[model samples]
Target: MQDEVDAVQRILSALADVGLDSITFVAEMSSTGRSVLHLLTFGPAVEAGIGPYPGSLILVEGAVPEPWRRRPHPVPRAAPAASVDAALLERTLRERIPDATGATEAEIAAAEAWLGVALPDELKALYRVTRGRWQDWGDDYAAAERVAQAVGCELFPLDELYVASALSRPCPWRFAATEAVVSPPDAAVQGLVGSPGWIVFGDNGGGDRIAVDLTPGPRGHVGQIIMLDHEQNIGASLLADSLTNLVVHQRGDRQSSYRVDQPTAVARVNIQSMTSIQAAAHPGLEVLSIGVWDGEPLSLAPVTGLPRLRTLTAYPGTLADPLEIAKLSGLEYLELGPEEWRVLLDAGAVPRTLSAAGIEVHGNRHPLPIVALANELLALWDRPPISQTILEGHVEV
Candidate 1:
């Protein structure tokens, strides 16, 4: 679900207050030299490990009134509970990661030795996980957006984890993390049938990154997607070029294996995990979905690699190739995440095809409207034009 304008603004302001400044805005308005209230701070908040803080990470919404104002956004909230004991959790993690130890110094030393870099003073204050060989480091580890300037290390995106806390969602960390503990999804559990969309679970399935046997609910199925929670390796997963209906994985566990049971022609994968799904180019591939789990600054490559790729998930950050892909012969589906949707709507990129072969996104609510619009548009394209006026109305939050 999306965040309320006020909540986002307050969060952004807090980021700014914390001494972050270098920023990037990926909204449609940002491209047109316009502005949306949301902002993303980048670079080191400080320089030379000394004086004058560079800038703050501020994603503020402009002071718009009414509909444009920051409204309460919906999200999947978790049950409220006690905070995890940092010391105990630390020990548990140490046991799981092997290198992580109960002592902070040992863990810090291990991170430094493995990652081949010195830990920033501030970074040491929080938990640190090295990007393992098979790990993607997207969902599992919430990196700080703005790293310490002196270290010259890239800032990690930890906003998603923080947002989970603000919304009172389940601590994604508590999910089966260690390989020994994380078992494969049972066939009986295969497919989330009750869910509106297809869901794929990733586990300790070795080189087979995705375990697709989850049970589905009675509700209508939109399509299949995979969730690779940082266990599989990107290059290895792509090597199979299986193109399962959906893909999902987390970050920091790239070594995990992923497999594609269906042929590329049969399935269109939507990957929300930090890893990119477009491995080999296939003209038949319909959609390439991506999302920013927290606030990690990741890029989505255009179908430049995939000749058949038509629909692309709209996430924040600049596109490697927009015009080129816009000209794709049969390109159609283009949906945005909660963060990118507002920008897409404002940018007026909603093509007639958007009415059909539409994009799906994550929010507190369902996206039946987008699907309906796409169906209507496709119907109109085949026959005579139908009045789409009814859909022109704004969706009530």
Candidate 2:
């Protein structure tokens, strides 16, 4: 350990010879071992991770970018009927691929029991005509292709069916706070991360999943088809009004119910944007991002009482009074500089409502003080503090 520390000191000493104070080293770790390391990157360190500064401490655990803990929204109404007959949908698949294999009644019942949710009649009927398990087709690509061509999707076998619960879609609080779950009264699908009523039936072959939505929006049928988009963290789009409709290969487009109802969900204050906080302030503002500015630092007074405000990110030195952040009782994400955070921590003004936070570091600054400030913020939520190890060594040079 001593030898390794001494080696780090020697390398850092050589890098410091370039005369830049904040030549930071960033090492981002991941469970997948895709961890990245920038050997001698310049600038202040805002991210949390492990990086040693020669004789000083290594940056440890960073704050969680966002925490996910949202539950599925309750569905008060029963699912409406599919637009077509289950029996007809079954026959259509049989006629399209008469030689295809299907799931047994006992197998179907077992699937329902396993999932703890009853399979909709149309899905059950479709599977009865063509069970899409890979083992059923062996290594025969033609069989799978035939099934996909018949069902308009790569179908999941009865045993593989699952409930698309909200927890299955992990989203960070920072990004989730900005999502608006608004379904038009006539909409066919509810805009949500996932629903207990959603039963996975197949895939779009492009990573998106096809599910039978039991919790329909105001105008949707109970067994309508919905697509759980892979790229989206929340919400599904309507593909068909019914399972039978989906089997017929007559697709319909349905969009996610997530929309920015108000124009000010996110406000950017900079020379090219809103230009001032006063102009950015709105009753419905959810995020306030203060970027680089040539003018004087701005005050948070204009947006203090914003009921919906949850995210505030001010560039270092851009806020005239950082303490005013305390007035924001609804903040979920807050990002500021080391000095601003110190002011907040010293005054005990950090908002308790925050679920995630960030630090904005600019120019060249040592990371130890920044790490100290980050640890303090993390401690506010009883989050694991970034550990530090101090190493003392003199450069041989």
Please report the candidate that would top lDDT against the real structure: 2
Write one digit per residue (lDDT tens) for candidate 2, span 88-158.
88888999889888889999999889899988788889989988878878879998899898898888887
Q: Model 2 compared with the native: what TM-score? A: 0.75
The candidate 2 region of ten consecutive residues with least summed lDDT is 53-62
Which tens-of-lDDT digit does each residue in 1-397 have in candidate 1? 3568888788679768978543333222333344333233223211111111111111111211111111222222321113222344333334444442122467557655644434332234334432222234343333221111111223222221111011121111101010011112321112211111111223232323232111211211111112333332111121111111111111222222222453343222334432444453355554445445444443444355555454455444424333333454553344443334434344544344332222233343333343333333334335322122121122233
TM-score of 1: 0.23
Question: Which residue ranges in model 2 land beyond 4 Å of their true spot?
Answer: 1-82, 172-174, 184-186, 254-284, 291-296, 362-367, 389-397
For model 1, what is the C-alpha lDDT against the true structure? 0.30
How well does candidate 2 score on lDDT at residue 333?
76
Residue-level lDDT for 171 in candidate 1: 16
lDDT of every predicted structure (CA atoms): 0.30, 0.72
Instruction: Compare the candidates by TM-score and give the number of the best one.
Output: 2
